[model samples]
Target: MSHLRIVRDEPPKRRERRPHVNHVLTHAEQAQARAALKGLRNAFGSWSALAAAMDVRITTLMAAARGAYNVSAALLVRASRASGLSIGDLLGKPIAADRCRACGQIKRRVA
Candidate 1:
């Protein structure tokens, strides 16, 4: 009996593409994001840690924290949910956790 050997060829390497720059945040939005990041940093210790808790990449967190890039509303929603803060809160609104997210009216505690 005779055995045959087969040879496999390696695939061509792909060229590395530069990272895409999608959007840039406005001054107001940037300030809000930075301030929120500051609050989060106190709790999470670092951007990487906060990103892990937020279920997002470190780069995404960094961009949002630094306001170096525009972030999607979805990301904001995720960050708000993860941080237990409303979107307005993350946006630097002077609302407390006891207040309604939209109207900012304080909710009475139920017995």
Candidate 2:
């Protein structure tokens, strides 16, 4: 009589969670990001051109523009720098009147 051996499959591994990696934007934020992306594309004349200016993949820009995925803070920073738009604008946050437009620092009152 021949002995039979049973084969068992290994359990699937759990994915490691990275903190502060993916940021899920709200509907309003998503709309703001989409609009900012559109403005960047128009300024650059093409998505590929804008992607090149931002130092990111064209597909990343395309996906962000389409709202297919979450937009990262890094991407927004790049967009802000490339398009001269504030990060607050991209995230749909209002710019505070007390904040400086160039540096975003609050103005100090003189005594």
Candidate 3:
């Protein structure tokens, strides 16, 4: 009797898209988040220090970064001011999230 060996030959699964939470930040927003995080770190001199200054738990900041949630406008403004980026530059043009991202048509939200 010969022993048979079974091997599973399957490629690793790749997710197409990851849905964001209540606030869906665009890809650009994600990039901005990275810059903002860097600014935040630089302003406070370190991640641990920033957390202390902001009175937020360090884990919260880490989670926000891991999840790719863009900092809120208020946070962005504060970070921009701290990091030497003008508010105008940080905001750029107003980008509304109320439009259908695929076609840019306005859509009403369900109540």
**Which has the greatest lDDT?**
2
Model 3 agreement with the true structure over 16-108: per-residue lDDT tens digits: 896755364567775666555655575567878866665556776666656544555555554555546565554444334354434668878
TM-score of 1: 0.55
Candidate 1: global Cα-lDDT? 0.72
Clashes of each: 0, 0, 0
For 8-68, candidate 2 gives per-residue lDDT tens digits of 6986688998765464667688777777787668667899999998999999899988888
CA lDDT of 95 in candidate 2? 44
Winner on lDDT (2 vs 3): 2
Every candidate's lDDT: 0.72, 0.77, 0.59
Each candidate structure's TM-score, on Cα atoms with residue i matched to residue i, is 0.55, 0.60, 0.42
Worst 10 residues of 2 by lDDT: 92-101
